[model samples]
Target: MIAKGTPFVASYSGGKDSTLALWRAVRAGGKPLALLTMLDETGGRSRSHGILPAVLDAQAAALGLPRISGQASWGDYERVFVEQLGRARAMGAVAAVFGDIDLAAHRQWEEQVCAQASLAPVLPLWGEDRLALVREFVDAGFAARIVVIRRDLMADDYLGRVLDHALIERMLADGIDPCGEAGEFHTLVTGGPLFAKPLALADGDVRADGDYLSLDFGLAASI
Candidate 1:
C-alpha cells in the first residue's frame, strides 16, 4: 500500500497531476508530511511550470502542509532536487511521491533521485489511463487552470483556461495528450478535496519562457 512509502513528501508541481497523485496517496494510507518544489536559479519561479512562490505557499497553506524547495539551474537540477529530497528525508519522510503517469524516462529519473536520497519512490498515478487520470481529478472536485504551454505543441490561447471536460475532450480530438505528460501544457491547481479552501487567483500577463509560454497569476484581493 502507498507504493511502499508512507509519511511521504510529495514532489509537488502546483499542478493537477501532482495534486491528484497526492490525493490518491493519502487515500492509500500515505502520510503526507510536506511538499517539495524545485525553483529556477533566479529563485523567483518554479522550474516545473513557472509558478510563483506565493502560489505554492497558498497551495501549501490550503493543504495544511509545509514546503521544501531549492533553487537550481538546469545544469544542477538533479543535484538540487536530491538535496531537497535529503532535507525531506531528514524531516522524517520515508518516501517521495510523484505524479508521473506513463513517462518511462520521467519515472526513471525520479526513482534515481529518490534512491540517491535513500527515500522510496511513490507513483500513485503510474500506468493509469491518461484521459481517465484527468477525468478523475476533475470528477473528484479538483479545479485547475492551464498556466503554461509549449509554443510548438499547443496554442497560446490555452493559457488561463480551466481544465474542464470540454477542454480535455478538445485536446484529445486535436491529438494532444490530455494529461499533458509529455510537456504539452502545465497547470496550477486552484481547489480540490485535499484543500481546506480554494485559492483565489487573479490573472496577469503572459510571458515567454524559451520554448514555453507562461501565464502570470497572483492571489486575488481578499474581499
Candidate 2:
C-alpha cells in the first residue's frame, strides 16, 4: 500500500486506461512521480501503440510530469519492462499504477513485476464493468485518440479518431469490445483532469502493416 506523499509512478502506454489510472492516482492524492514507458527498438516509439517517444515526452510535459523510458527489442519486452520498473523503484518510487481492467493474466503480470521491484501494484479501475468504465473515463473529461488498431479486428478508418461515446457505441454494435480489451484498438491520451495543460496534437497519415494499423501524429506543448 502507498502512504500519502509516497512517490508512485504510472506505467503509461499513452492509452486510455493508463491515463485513467494516472488520473485516479492523482485523485487519491498520490504524487505524479513519473511516467514510465517502453520504447521499441525498431524506433523510439511506444511498443504497444507505435507512438513516437518525442510525442509521449510532449504529453508528459503537458501533464507537468517527468518520464522514464528505455528502448526494448521485440524479444526483450517483458525483461525490459520489469527493468524499467526496477529503475523507478531504485529512485524511491514505492508504488506502481497499471490500467488493466479484468484480465487475469495482465493482473498477474503486474503483480509479479511490482513484486520483483518491491513496489505495490495499484489497480484503481480493476474489475469494473467495461461499458461503464468507458463511459466514466469520457465523462470525467479525458480526451483520447485511437493510435493503433489491429487490422483484422478494426478498420483503418478508426485510426487517429477520438474515442468518444459514439465510437464506443459503434464498437459495441460491431461486436467489438468497447474498451478494445481484445486487442481491437489502442489509444493515446492528449488531455484530461490529471493534465496541468492539454497536449496539442495534430493527426497525420495512417499506415497499414501486417496485422496492425499505425496512426501518425505529433504532440507539442510549451515547456
Candidate 3:
C-alpha cells in the first residue's frame, strides 16, 4: 500500500466504479499523479469499458491530471499493462488503485499485475456489499450511461440509458448484479463530483458485435 499522502496511479476505465474509486482515494488524502488506461490494439478505445480516447482525454482534462495509456491486443495485454504500471512506478506511484468489488479472480489478476510492476494493489471497494455500493454511487449523483450490454444477459433496450436507482432496482429484481460485475454490461461516466466540468457528449450509432451491443455515445465527446 502507498504511504499516506504519497502519489499513486489509478487503473481507470472512465467508468462509474473506477471514477468512484479514484474520487474516494482522493478524499482519503491520497495524491493521484495520473490515470492509467489500457487501450485496445487499435489504440482507439479503452480495453475495459470501450471508451474513446478523446473522451477519456477529456476526463483527464476535467480532473486536471495527466492520462497515460498502454495499447495491446489480448495476446499482449498483460505485458503491455505491466509496462504501463512500470511507467506509473517511474512516476512515483507506490500503489495502484482499482474499483473491483468482490470478484476474486479480478482481484487476483490485479494483484499479479501490480506485483510484476512492483506496486501494491489497492481495491477501495473490495468485499463491500454490491447493492450498498451501487446505492452509494447513485446517492453521489454521478451520472453514467450504459454503453455496452451483453444482449444475452440483458435487453438491448437498456443501452444508452442513464444509470439511476430505479434502473438498478429493476436490474436487481431481474437477478442482475447492480454493478453488472458479471459481464452483463458496462458504462461510461459523464459527470460526477470529481469532474471540474461535465462532458459534452452526443449519442452516436448503436451497433452489434456478436452477442454484445454498444453505443458509441455520439462519437464526438469533448469537454
Across 1-223, the per-residue lDDT of candidate 2 in tens digits comes to 2356768989999889998888887777787678998888865678888888778988888888889987888788778888888888888888999999999999998999889888899998899999998899999999988988998998778888889999998888889898889988899888888677777887766778899888888753422
Question: Which pairs clash (backbone N, Cα, C closer than 3 Å) in model 3?
Answer: 202-218, 203-218, 204-218
What TM-score does model 1 achieve against the real structure? 0.95
lDDT tens digits, residues 78-123, model 3? 9999999999999999989999998899899999999999998888
Cα deviation in Å at residue 77, candidate 2? Answer: 2.0
Reference-based TM-score of each model: 0.95, 0.93, 0.95
lDDT of each: 0.91, 0.85, 0.88
By lDDT, the candidates rank as: 1, 3, 2
* Model 3 CA lDDT for position 36: 94
Higher-lDDT candidate of 1 and 3? 1
Worst 10 residues of 1 by lDDT: 1-10
Off by over 4 Å in 2: 1-3, 220-223
Show how many residue pairs clash in every candidate, following the order shown. Answer: 0, 0, 3
Q: Tens-digit lDDT track for model 1 on 54-141? A: 9899999999999999999999999999999999999999989999988899999999999999999989899989889899999999
Residue 79 of model 1 has an lDDT of: 98
* Worst 10-residue lDDT window, candidate 3: 214-223
